[model samples]
Target: MSMLVFFFVPAVIFLTVVAPIWLILHYWTRSRQNKGLSDEERQTLEDALSVAERLEKRVATLETILDAEHPNWRTAREDDYRRGGS
Candidate 1:
């Protein structure tokens, strides 16, 4: 009756406040424990990044020359506008 509801109300309120905090900490610890990458994996990532950096440098040099020659060449916004109306 009223006594039962009073006890149940506090229990529900306590659970509402505490459940999310408990679950968040639980998942955070689990993710840190589970998602560790090995040293070899990190080395592979560094190698891939180096290759990407070299390619980006080359593309940037080409873009600089293109920009100097034709400033408005192949702007994506202009291309999109042309395509949209046509």
Candidate 2:
């Protein structure tokens, strides 16, 4: 019926076109608004950094032992030509 077409045509257009555009724009803006690190993630990163600092000290101790055992042993920076130093 013409009345049915008149009622549903605009609704179908709104659903198919306007609604999708609105949804896409809304999601795009929301994603932009949420771009920064969350507080929990920042805290976790700080913890990881502290763990890394501890590990670095441990690695330095290991490196000292390694150097003592092998007098001619070279670090990655000392022997640029050698492979697999790191």
Candidate 3:
């Protein structure tokens, strides 16, 4: 029983003290490592932004062309919607 107490006390102390700190530190560093965007992720974000900008400009250009070609296109589209026309 004395030998068991000797080993058990240290094991209990380690579990109560060291184990939690170790777990917290392990997860903290892992989270910190993943906190920032990687270079490839940054490049992908830039590419997505560029494509979005181009698509936005294309939409504006298309709207302008539609305005010139059919001045009442917006109203016509709304009317079509109201009438449930596909």
In terms of lDDT, the best-performing candidate is: 3
Model 2, 1-86: lDDT tens per residue? 99999999999999999999999999999999899999999999999999999999999998899889986666545786565454
Cα lDDT, all candidates: 0.89, 0.90, 0.99
Q: For candidate 1, lDDT tens digit of each residue in 4-70?
A: 9989999998799888899999999999987977899999999999999999999999999988988
Full ranking by TM-score: 3, 2, 1
Candidate 2 wrongly placed segments (more than 4 Å): 69-86
Regions more than 4 Å wrong, model 1: 1-35, 84-86
RMSD, one per candidate, in order: 8.6, 4.9, 1.0
Give me the candidate number with maximum TM-score. Answer: 3
Query: Which pairs clash (backbone N, Cα, C closer than 3 Å) in model 2?
Result: none
Candidate 3 lDDT at 62 equals 100
lDDT (Cα, 0-100) at 3 in candidate 2? 100
In order of lDDT, best first, we have 3, 2, 1
Stronger candidate by TM-score (1 vs 2): 2
